[model samples]
Each structure stands twice: as structure tokens, then as C-alpha cells.
Target chain A: MKKLQIIALIFSILFAIIIVQSCKSTSNITESKFGAQLWGENCIRCHNTPSPETFSDTEWDVAVMHMRVRANLTESEAVKIADFLKTAN
Target chain B: MAFGQLYKITKEISNQVNIHKMKNLIILILSFFLILLMNQNVKAQDIQSTDEIQKLKQEIELLSKQNNSYKPGKSQFLLRGYAHSGLQTNNNGFSFVGGSFNPLLIYKQSDRLLFETELEMELVGSAVELGIEYANISYLLSKNITIRAGKMLVPFGIFVPNLHPAWINKFPTAPLGAGHEGILPTNDIGVEIRGGSYLGNLKVNYSFFAVNGGQLNDGMEEPEEAGIIHHGIFPDNNNGKTIGSRIGIFPFSNSSMELGFSAMYGKTGARESDVEDIKALHYAFDISYVKTLSSMSSVLDLKAQYTGVNVSDANYPEHDDPDELYTFDNKSKTWFAQLSLRPALVENPIVRNLEFAIRYSDLLTPEGAEWHVNQSQTDVGINYWFDWRTVVKFSYRIRSGFEGGHSEEPSHGGVEEDGGNSFFIHWAIGF
Candidate 1:
């Protein structure tokens, strides 16, 4: 079991490195992209991410605020998400 | 000479009376003209007031338009839902289960007002049970505060509010002691004040709520052996209200780690006469850490939580005979740890969205209980995310201690026995 776990860990690390290199080489990450990326990365872990156009600016503010506490999101991350959602529509 | 004098007197009297009548007619005509002039003046005043009202209406309409323009987006209505179905096998046999159809509705009534509701329908055997998961209206009081009222998921722990949704839950089943019959209440009808604020490098988030308290249930035949205290979702049986609060802090600016603490306290008794006011207190501490390895293109998430509940000096009196009473240890504790790794950082498109997760949970009942009440479980799962809102999950769960029976009676049925193992596969989607 220990050997298997170690092997799994090593394999994961190698795959991660390759993925990161591929991502860095492919795209330019902007603030909006970063926000969207985080939204896709974190928000989707537990549920589907709602469309930014699904809510108005004020509504997004409230929704993000509620989710921040519920999901244990950082203030900056929540703000970025809020900004993305506001502009997404 | 006498006839001519009489005719002169008659003509003089007639002339005087005619002159008086003419004077009276002139005065009556003048009075009618004065009344008409007064009515014209009143009509002029009415017209002036009507013009003022019209101007006010126009101003109000203009103000409304301005308000609408100031709002950045139009009101939104969203409908989202998920369905879960699976098969499980244990010591009994393999059985097909119809899990649930959960529908959520969110309406943005205005810039400051929002209404959201979720309904859950789960198939238990052949019968379907419907439950309102949460139905609440929230109003933004300010930038940093909001007030919500109605039925809401209890905010006591991280799992209930954050990971309870089928699409988001990493594993097929909930953690031990985190379910509805766990140590703490899962949902409550209440009013809550919640928001987030920044203090220095740390972001603080908080929720404080008051809800209907718990209730006491004792079996009619075996009052002493079956008596148990648990959460109540319906109206309060007594005046006492449960107060719960959770506060979390993220010290890092990058949103990587968070620590939170939650507590609830209230009396749980139907009436003063049935039992001494059984005051229930619950506490939980939780932590979550997430890190993205830029080099590996992988994200790692670690989470853990510890929760406990204590009932103060509980005494159960026999329903038929109040004189006969019994007491039991009214304490319960539970904890869980979980780890998840997403290989999305991998360059391979096929494996990028796949995630592997493992979790362990333990639950304990108070000492000197009527039945054995210690349980531990381990689960390993894999999730494939088609999108943020859609997922396919498969998990293997190994459960020890306690078989199929009532949660209240730990000694009944398969007490102190292995619960066997099961495997489940579910597809969840939300839009």
C-alpha cells in the first residue's frame, strides 16, 4: 500500500508539471480569464457555476457574498469572481 | 267730488307697492351673480391643484426611470436542478435506489432583494418523499450585511451548506454525523444575518441565526430505553429559540486557506412539565486548505471538521406516569477529514478534468447509552466533471458499526455490528 501510494503521488506530480507547462505555453491569462478560471476551478467543484448573465451586478454581489462564506472563498477571489460575473453579461 | 278723491288714493297706493317689488327683484338678481362669481373662483383653485398633481406624477415617473438606469443589470430568474440515482449492496443484498430530484429556483426581485428555493424529492422504496430543502428571502442591508428569513440550511458546519448539493459532493454519501440525524440540526426555519468583511490581511465571514429548537422523543413502550433528543424542523413547541453562529477567517490574500468555528445553544423541551428544560449546546471547528501547483497543473484541497453536541441535565419522564423518570448521557461527537486532487493541470485533455478523493469519518455517542453507538467509515471516490455543473461519480464505501435500524436506538437491530460495504455510481447535472 505504501509503495502504491508513493507511486500514485509521483505520477500525479509528473502529470501536474506537464499540465502546468502546457497551460503556460498556450494562453495569456488575463484578470477576467483568471476570474473565470477560478470560477470554473473552484465553484464547479461542488456545483455548476451559474452564468454571469444570470444575475445583475447587485445580485451577483449578494450571491458572491453569500457563497464566499458558504464556500470559504477569499475576499480577493470573491471580488474577482464578482467582477467577472458583472462583465460576463 | 268724493268719487274723484277715492280713485286718486287707490292709484297712489298701487304705485308705491309696485316700486317696492322692483327694488326686491333687483337685490335677488345681484345675490345670484355673487354666488356664481364665488363658484368660478373655486373652479379656478381646483384647476391649479390638478396641475400641481400632474407635475408631481411626472416627477415620480422621471425618478423611477433614473433609478432603473442606475441599476446595472435587469432582474434575473434562474432555474437549476440535479438528479441522482444509484445502486448499492450490503449484507442484505444489491438494491436499486432512486435517489432524488432536486430543483432550485433563484429570483432576483430587485437590486436589493432576492428569493431562492430548493425542493427535494427522494424515492424511498416505492414511495416518494418530498421535502423543502430551503426557501428564503434575503435583503441586502448594506455592502457588508444581509438579512434573510424563512427556512434555510443550517450554517453550523462546512459540509451542510457547501458540499451538500449532489453535483458538488465529492463522495456519494455524506460524512458520518453530518447527515440530518447527526449531532447537529441539518436545516432550520429561522432568520439569519450573514456577510463578509475585511480586517487587515484577513477576510472574515460570518452567519448568525435563530431557529426553532429541538424536540424530545421517547418510545411509548420503553420510555427510559428509547428516549432521545433531536432537532426539530417544524414550529417550536416552546418559546425557547435556538441561536447558532459560524465565523470563518481566511488569512491569506490568495484565498488558499480558511479556518472557521461555529456554535449553537438553545433549550429543547416540549413543555416545562414534561422534562426539565433540556438545554442543547453544539460546537464545530473546521479548516480547509486549497493550493494550485503551478508546476504540476494540479490542485489539491484538504478539509477537516470536528463537531460535538451536549444536552444539559436531561431527564425523561414516562409519558403515562410522570413519577417514573430516567436519565442518560446526552453527549455526541463526530469528526471527518478529506483530501481531493484534481489532475486538470495535466496536459492530456481526457484526464484533465478527473478528480480523485478520499475521506474518513468517525461518530461517537455519549457514554453509558442504552445501545452501542460508535461508528467509523472510509470512502474512496473518483469524479469526472463534464462541466462545472455536471459530474459523474463512483465511490466505494466501507462502513463499520451499526446496521440498518433507527438512528435513535443504537442498540436495536444490528447494534455493534459491521455495516458491510457498498459501491455507488451517480450522475448529477445542474443548469
Candidate 2:
């Protein structure tokens, strides 16, 4: 019985060590992940870091048009921006 | 070996935990600094926006002040016209008085330059005429000298060339053509030099004129024989030249208590009624006193005038008799007196215009003549000023003159029983 207890204890220790290592590696990866593609290039210019659901589609439409003039958007770009605004909110 | 390995692993785990806590502390501090920086940045942005709004408000105020400086100065335009239609009933028959339309247009280019013209229907059709009632661009030459050119009213007596019955006095029996004799042609279409200087508390105006004479009519274009000639006075434009002067004194601004006197002498044009153009000479003199008394109750105006004319008859070349006294060479004197009042009425809030007035005048023919025919005229009128440039007027007039003794022969004298009454209503709008 004593021998069995010792073996079980060794296995459990190994598992715990593996779990810690994986958790550390995953957290580091999350921190380094680039949000620039989702935010900086598109959303961050008009919106803060808040959720998109904060504004309604109509509100977003007005906000986007107001910014579009300054952004110098072409017709197609403006349409795309409107579509993005509607869906974002 | 197993024990040593276990210790080393545990020790590494402990160090990792410590490092995680330190990382969290660093993140908290950095986040606090970021929040402070963001709050400061937002405050600065708000201040900048406020400054921009104030600057915009100031710019708007400056633009409004610049708009009010481009408006025009003192200017005047005149539109004068009369339209009349009358129905008369009498024991003999019912007659419809012919309607007449007299239209006059006048424009003032400045304080001095004036151009005027008048057109009216006459027995022979339309009589169209134009004259420079007053033309010399006046320069405040001095405190005393006022030199003028371009036609002017011959400063003689109380009447000027343009003083027609349709304008100043609309009394039917008011010795119509008596005021303007061949004596002092009221208008001399010539140049004049004048001076209006103040002496102490008195104001004086003196003017001299050289003019073209021989322009006269009884406010009507019908044949001279068709209308009753007041005091046997007819305009004989047969005059060629005339010189005259006027002197006046004003005691106060509200009251023009003045005495104006003037005289003129000139050669006259031939009479259209006669075949031959004869040599004619004329002399005229006039004097008048005008006073205005203002009281809290009402305002009153009193005026009187006397005029005399001497003319050499054109048809009867050998005779120097004035038309009034055909027997003993030609000479006539016509005179009149008038009083007027304006009773203050309710003040209008919407239109703060001036009040209305009522006036009466008694005009007589040649004085001391066998005929003592005179006119009784009374008028009640209202005047409203919309602005400095526009005015509207309504008036009613009652006159008794044409019905009196208006026999062609002076010896017959006038019959008061034959006199008739006339009533008229007038509306005038002008700018």
C-alpha cells in the first residue's frame, strides 16, 4: 500500500507541473497578441475602447458621416464604412 | 537527488508568484498615471473650444456694425395730381361738372437743383408745361450772400409764378388771376442772387431775380373767355423781361411772422386773343404779414396780403388801361386774408404721424372798385406721414363764389342771390 501511494503522488506532481507551465505560456501569448488589426486600423479612430453595442446603428451612421468628410472617403469607401458602422453597433 | 530536485522546483514556483504580483503593481501605477494624463488633456481641449467660441462671437458683432454705414442721405421726390368728378343740381337743369385730371411731376436732385412739369386737360385739350421752379445749386456763399442761377420765382408780393390755385389756396372765389398781374410776373426763368442772414434774434431773407415774363393762366386751360376772370385779370405772356426782389423776416422758428414785399417791370409778349403784338409794360407790388401762434390747446395761423398791378393793354395799343379798369388806362389791385388752425387729436400709437387741420380764407377782387364780389372758402383736411419720404392726405372743401354776381360787365356788379355752393373731397398720396 505504501508503494502505491508513492507512485500516485509522483504522477499527480508531474501533472500539476505541466498545468502551470501551460497556463504561463498561454497568458504570455494573450498579452503579446496584436489587436491593431481589429482596432487601430478601423474602430479606434472614432470609437474608444468601449464595446460597439454602446451606440445604435442610426447614431453610428451620423457619427461615421461626420468623420467620413474628414477622412476623405470615396463613394465606395463611404458605403463600406457605413456598412461597418451598422454592423459594429 | 529527489529531495534536492523537489526543493529547487518549489523555490522556482515561489519566485514566479512574486514576479506576477510585482507585474500587477507596476500595471496599476501606470494606469493611474494614464488616467491623470487623460483628464488633463481633456481639460485643455475644453478650454481651447471655449476660446474658439468667444472669438467667433466677437467676429459676428464686428460684422453687424459695418452694415449700418451704407445708407443714403436726405432726398425728396414730388408727385402731384388732381382728379375730380362732380354732379350739380339746380332749378334750371341738372349738369355734370366735367372731370379734370391735373398731374405734376417734380424731382429734387439736391438741396438746390429741382426739375418740375405739369400736365392737365383743357378746353383745347391737354396743356403740357415744364419749368425749373427753383434751380441754382445753393452754396452757403457766406453768412450773407446766396447767389442763384437757373429760373426762379420772381420775388414779388406774396405770389410766385408757380403759385397756382391748385396748390396753395384752393378757394373757388379767391380772386383767381388777380394775384399774378402783368405787373410782377411771379416766375422770371432767369438768374438771381439772394442773401438770408440773421441779425440779432431776427432772420432775414433777401432775393433778386431777372426772369422771363408773360406766363399766366387762371388754373384752367380753357379759353380765357370761357372761365370767369377774377377781377378782370388775365395772364398776358406778352412779357419779355422782368426784374424783382423779395425781403422777409422771421421772428421765430415756430412762428413765421414776416412781411415780404417785391416789384417787377418788363416788356410783355403779344396777347394771343388779339391779332397784333403790341408794346406792353407792367408793374406789380405786394406786401403781406404772416403769424403763427402756438398754444397748448391748438395752433393758429393768420395771414393777409395786398397786391396791385398796372399793365398796358395789348389789343387797344393806344390805351394803358389795366384789364380791371378798362375806362381810365389799365390798373388793378387784388387782395386777400386767410386764417388756419390745427386742433390736436388722439395720438396714434401704430403710426405716430402728424395731426389734421382746418382753414378758411376770404379773397376779394380789385379793391375799391364798383364790384365788391368776394369768395368764401373753408377746408378741413388730414395729413399722415408714413416716413420722411411719403405722405397721405384726405380733405374736404366748401366754397361759394361761382354763384355770386359774375357778370361780364363790371358796371352790373355782383348778385349775391345768384351765388352757388360747391363741395369737394380730395385724397392725395405723395412721396
Native contact fraction, candidates in order: 0.11, 0.00
Model 2 error, position B396 (Å): 10
lDDT by residue (B57-154, candidate 1, tens digit) is: 99999999999878655466666667776666667767665677888877777756878888888765567778888899888665556678988888
Cα deviation at A1, candidate 2, in Å, is 99
lDDT of 2 by residue, B278-357 (tens): 22233333333332234434334444556555544423222132343222233544454555443322255433344354
lDDT of 1: 0.69
What are the per-model DockQ values? 0.07, 0.00
- DockQ, candidate 1, comes to 0.07
Docking class of 2: incorrect
Number of backbone-clashing residue pairs for each candidate, in the order shown: 5, 18
Best by DockQ: 1
